[model samples]
Target: MATLEDDEADIDPVKMILLDEEGEEKKLTTLDNGAAKPQMQKHYIRSIESTVAIRQLPSEGLSFQLWPAATTLVTLLDGYLSHLSESPLATTLTALSNGGDNGRKLKILELGSGTGLVGIAAAVTLGANVTVTDMPHVIPNLKFNVEANADVVARRGGTVDVAPLRWGEDDDMEVIGREFDLVLASDVVYHDHLYEPLIQTLRFLLNAGARGGEKKVFIMAHLRRWKKDSAFFKKARKLFDVEILHTDPPKEGSRIGVVVYAFVGKN
Candidate 1:
């Protein structure tokens, strides 16, 4: 007993049908909260993937002031796994990328870790001990996210430590005693004004070098912009033997720029 109005409504279709990861057909939500959150908040996730190797980032307002960020994060970790010959970390460490040798249990440090995605991914992927550090204001979310990723750590057989570190602070470094086998930073160079202090922190955390004394490998992922300074790369090079290991364009015809820096600590 359908009326003309009912037929018209059916034809119009209030919502489009969509499929979930499991391929269940469902109506697309008109009010999609998953797109992005505006509030500065934090939420937990018990799981992320079945890889048995990946950390889950807390979903709520996790201070991601950086853009092209979530995807870029995936890229950084992906690069870490694939940049076999490109990465400048300890030879033994890089050798483990293929999971051929999971013997490496490195002490890693991540600075300016917005939500600990890059560091968490590394810890999960490499089974390394990761120390994720950011400013005090950013620590709570970082800690929450790390906890959210507990399953990932447990499955991957690695540990992630969250801590607070301020840029350009000497006393802080003296207290923390930057001792790490690998150093990572992602999307941290957006603020040209804060570059020097950020670089200083990197210097403190990095291991000696591939020469095998104190320093170790350091990797930084960034989005290149037309307005960015050419000297930025030069400055990093002057401080350490910096090299370009990988560059990935925006994903799937998307408009985003990304590049990773592989630095060999100078003796």
Candidate 2:
């Protein structure tokens, strides 16, 4: 519903995004090469769809065409089904199963929500109000996927919004200026260049400003890349009162690791 993306800035929906076809640079066999530089160009097209069955391109530039690597987007239409563990599906379901007697209707937002799985899972299983966001580059495809599938989300009385959000630099949280019940992000801490900016963004968008929950409440998921991810987490912990909210790395040949994080407040 609210967004702030500079049209001039080029965006790559899949790569920088956690939920789509884009990959972790350390894992990318190409960018890992020392000889390569940040060549400003677009190269590929990958078909990605939302749970509702709307398909769009994840990689929308350059000459390369991409294929979904078992990870893709989900929508409200799928009714919040989760194929993976380590996801909040079970947690949310438990809470919601109580039947809202807790005076708690959750308002949640997910940063870098790839195919909308987590958000969708929360929406369906927990019936939390959710928002899915990503870079301007990925907004088009993200929205298209959401549009294609609205059925799943509609059933649980869950509402999902797709917005444009960038990890680094200027952010527009004002348009979305209200406080949230739960904030989440997945696979967003792998970039060194984005380190500080990501922290700043979190502080800006979260942190209850001496009011709300006495701090911000957030849960983040990432596949651990020791050096890069640990460094970021260590520094981030210094900024917020943090706890190892959760962790469930893939066993073997699972292709990815999964960890959950919860931040209480800012330092």
TM-score of decoy 2: 0.62
Q: What is candidate 2's lDDT per residue for 17-95, written digit by digit as tens?
A: 2232244332222334343322221212111222333343323431112222212222211223342433344454343
Instruction: Please list the C-alpha lDDT of all candidates, in the order they appear.
Output: 0.58, 0.51
Candidate closest to the true structure, highest lDDT:
1
**Model 1, range 1-267, lDDT digits (tens) per residue?**
731212222221122222222324333222265643332222122233333222222243234433343334444455455543344433435543333225647777888887676677777766778888888878877787788778867787879998888877998777666657677777666556777887787677664342245456677776544234344565777778876565656543334446666776566
Clashes of each: 7, 21
Candidate 1 residue 258 Cα shift, in angstroms, is 0.7
Top-scoring candidate (TM-score)? 1
Off by over 4 Å in 1: 1-62, 65-70, 73-104, 207-214, 251-256
What is model 2's C-alpha RMSD? 11.0
